[model samples]
Target: MNLRNIQYPFLFEVPVLKHMAGFAGLLKRDPRGWPSDRPVVGMFLCLDPLIFCCQPQPRPFGVAHHLATRFPDETFVFLVPITMSLERRVNALALAAQHRRFQKTHPRASLIILANTRDEERLLRRLGVDVRYAPQNMFVDEGMYHPIPGRERRFDAIYNAQLAPFKRHELARTLPSCAYVTKMFTTWSPQLKRQHLGKFVCSLPYNHVILNDVTADDVVPMDHVKVNRAMASAHVGLCLSGLEGAMYASIEYLLAGLPVVSTRSRGGRDVFFHPDTTLIVDDDPRAVQDGVVAMKARALPPDYVRATTLRLIAEERAHFNVFIDGLRGRQVDRTDPRWSFEYAHKLARFGSISEFEALVRAR
Candidate 1:
């Protein structure tokens, strides 16, 4: 796991590496043939290394593209967040064309693991790259989120997300009975604080929302343990996100055996939502209020919630293995009933050219 000798020639200048070193260390120790002296470089070359390419941010994408171009002989695997629909900021057509060009020019040099489902696949295919679905990494630690049999339900509702604009924390202004648990500040730098003062001020109104006949406490950030405890004691959880990759907070609520009242998450949360477990509503105040009332009145079986969480956890792990195995030039058992045809096709399609040649020699 020692990465002291590892060289990140391109990313050495990036400030975020300091925060990511520990996670990189864990990747260095994985049995997936991670490069010992050049761990970052190894990640690109390793047989199916799981690279979490967060948010499709410009910098990360540039870095990955640079590495893939520089080391064309190596295979790069990326877990990417695919936008379901084109946003004002994102050009889905151009992005898919870029991927197609890369795949065509470099062939087996890169593989994309998409976070969203069939919609992303369809979009990418229209853009000329046939993308396949992979399970979004949304698993929670079971030990942290499991239900406590005798814990008292103290709060009527809880909102478990950061005080960010996309999360729609202002929705709490409409739900007077809900407790808002969110971070006080995004960063500590005074200069940055001054820059973000408008956004900070905009979030301040949520703190003034009346709850339980009193002005609720200023939203305070707590560690996972405290958040889990608060969720365990709450009767329901609220997720008012305008969009989501997976809505991790909603999954946490379900894992804690609390019925979730959520707006359409517009992503992977659709896989988990059911009438028996969740109340999906529009972004309106009255609809949320009615959904909250319905959620409280309905009875959700704790065992069902627990079972669903476990099932998702298993699926995430299995699909992740499939991704890894595909990257490693290992043949997945096609005869196995659990093997997905799309997964098999992607493995065979993007497999290393040398590996395919070796397979031909063996045959």
Candidate 2:
């Protein structure tokens, strides 16, 4: 798929130097104003051929350079948002180098830099690239989908995700009185398309099921406003996604002050905290039931849960903002102790932080 087709507006072009007196001292200050004219349209280039076993290869550097160089001529801001990992910084630098070389060759290009992860920010800073960070573009704000007060809610739990063999095996039986939210329309997941069709066929006379997909016109997954409201109204929000990336649902649940019941799905674990605002359980029916019961019996304080989740989001956003700033020719301050220079240097110089941390823990 052409990633450029899914375009987002590129951002944070105003130079940090213009905002503050000193380049180094800019790190201590917070940005107050933004450019009224948002010019760049963020682009994510899908280079499947440049990927090796779900990992990006350096060969794509050539393609990224070409795209970045050409994008500015069209008056669109191009951005590359990658998943956070050890190789993230390395990959970012490789791509930034391409952009830099292209810019040097063609000095008139209107190239803006944007990245979305902590490691990416550190990499851009080390490379001395004009980069900036943007909020990971997660549209899960609580203001959009909030619960209606004084109105009685009929459902106890809302389960939204794909229905596959494993998910069905785990949730074959139903919890009493819970609203089982399923998709009304099936999407293009080759692996689970058939399984989902079979599950929908068989999942009758079991419990109250809300069989609706995002594709369905009638069913609307809680918008940002409804999301907040749902978290407050519903006893629990359950997600059994077999795969994910920073599940927006989890963030929504947290922001809504609702306890989340989720499986140990990949990105789910990266974000959700157990017993804090979310209950991470294996794909076991009994475990899920018990978790829901516990959540229903005694929900965490709304203020405490909201505060904690909001704090996490804020930190994540800060790291995100710094990354974009670096891409837009604003490198992070290496003089600041709080900067991620030490971590990046450690990772780049010594191979892997996990390996180092493990060895240290062993001793």
Candidate 3:
């Protein structure tokens, strides 16, 4: 099928499901050259509009290069670069190779890589990719994830990461009371989801709660509302990744009015971190646990955390707005609360393209 005909990249299919996802040893060969063949994130292709994709880490199997090759000349593209200063699986050499193909295949198509941190911007620039610093988490839906006043904080920390090794879940194993609102091949068969999640749950020492558990009952991975409530029930949120794209969970935690304990690493997940409510620690179990304990002990007000983080997020959004306005040759009023793109994080949250557009219409 022609990717050009496919308006929604989420629907991109591989030859088979087994070869689609690069992780969990699902693929027979290295996905370094081409990660998930399936469309794992939101992407759009059109004749008139500026083509865009909220690409996740582990680049999707030469898909971007295909877009460059197929799209009309001088098509503009924006990408949110994954922070991968150090992670064996995120082969920068392969990423560079795929992107170099993207540039060569469509030399006239201008692509702007969005970075959460200056370091990431520099990294992409070194790779000969045009980049700008704009924390993508600035677009998270605050309406979906505000503090629920009545819920008591039950878990000391909740990690909203997918079950990938690069996410570094092992670091959080020692935490006394934690929650895994994790997503592990949630689209796969129930038996497979249950088999792996059961083992993972059993391995964790003090997991007060585990979302998407078929081991306990037949619960699929939650939608946004449930994830927000689960986050509210935790005293702190955790970002354990040593490298990744803007871990959307960091901003999700702050928006849910929870203080965050994050390991210092690449990828600008910490861009919106409130200095008083957030702590960055070494990538050690003891450090992570201690940081969580300290943040929890501070007894910071939930509203304060939410408000401060929103302000920081707003600043980043405003910066991005100016840049986009320049590109469009007209201001689109992006900061207007009712603007359709206000909560574009739905790109990641919504599984289907129709669901994403419907929510956009509702707003």
C-alpha RMSD values across all candidates: 11.7, 17.1, 8.7
Overall local distance difference test of candidate 3:
0.64
Output the number of the lDDT-best candidate: 3
Q: What TM-score fits each model?
A: 0.63, 0.51, 0.73
- Candidate 1 — what's its lDDT? 0.53
Q: Given candidate 2, what's the lDDT at residue 316?
A: 59
Quantify all predictions' global Cα lDDT against the true fold.
0.53, 0.44, 0.64
Query: Tens digits of per-residue lDDT for model 3 on 96-126?
Result: 5555665675677666666667776666677
**Better candidate number, 1 or 3, judged by TM-score:** 3
User: Per-residue alpha-carbon lDDT of model 2 for 202-246, expressed as tens digits?
Assistant: 565455555344332324444344434444545777776544334
Decide which is better by lDDT, 1 or 2.
1
> What's model 2's lDDT at 276?
71
Report the lDDT of model 2 for residue 103: 61
The ten-residue window of minimal lDDT in model 3 covers 5-14
Error of 1 at 119 (Å): 1.4
- If both were scored by TM-score, which would come out higher, candidate 1 or candidate 2? 1
TM-score of decoy 3 = 0.73
lDDT of model 3 at residue 239? 93
Candidate 2, overall lDDT? 0.44
Q: Give me the displacement of residue 242 in model 3, in angstroms.
A: 2.0
